[model samples]
Target: MPQNKAAIATQDAPAAIGPYSQAVRSGDLLFTSGQVGFDPASGALVSGGVEAEARQVLKNLAAVVGAAGLQMTDVVKTTVFLADMNDFAAVNAIYAEAFAGAEVMPARSTVQVARLPRDARVEIEAVARFA
Candidate 1:
């Protein structure tokens, strides 16, 4: 069995708010920690509603994936957490556009949660495979 390796974090994404790496790579697989709507520049939640927040979350995820020496196309799976299910359609639309050209359209699961760090509307994490 391969050992789990720590994935490097990037300045392109907001730094982890707690004691966690942005992502970890083991063998060919990379697992990202959940990212919220915080903007990297200010390290604060981007001022917006669910739609905008969701976009930021994806942007952050993209940054982490890139830091792992992989592109968004490498992603094979994702998990989305939303403060409310009412934003599902909007989030899905944005997510689709983001991964529109991804070589591997990842399988995904989204869940509605009572709350998230920073009280942000959306948080997203992904798993990618290095080819």
Candidate 2:
């Protein structure tokens, strides 16, 4: 196995607001930090409600995953946090489509939270593996 390590950064996706990269690739595994609805280029929240923000979050995650040299299909696990359970069905609708119609889905857990950083309605983090 290769011992060299590297980080992935992409202009297509939102940049890390804090002290973190978009994604880190190590030994065939990629870990993406929790992504919110903020647009990295503009550094502002995507203009819309829950559905729109959720879509942006998913898109951002996709970009980070791609930066790690992987696709949504490569995602092995995910954890989704939402501000409200009422948005479950609505969020699921968009979340399902974000996976690009893949048949094999990753293990996932969704939960309602009291709040999140930046007051985002949703946030997502993922783990992927590459050969």
lDDT of each: 0.91, 0.86
lDDT of 1 by residue, 1-131 (tens): 65568757999999888899999998889999998989999998998688889889999999999999998889999999999999999999999988999866899999999999989998999999998
Best by lDDT: 1
Q: Which segments of model 2 are wrong by more than 4 Å? A: 1-5
Model 1 lDDT-worst window of ten: 1-10
Can you give the lDDT of residue 31 in candidate 2?
83
1-131 per-residue lDDT for model 2 (tens digits): 65666778888787777898778887888988888888877978888888999999999999889877788998889899999989889888998898765667888999999998878899999888896
Clashes of 1: 0
Q: Each candidate's TM vs. the true structure?
A: 0.94, 0.89
Which residue pairs in model 1 clash with each other? Answer: none
* Cand. 1 TM to true fold: 0.94
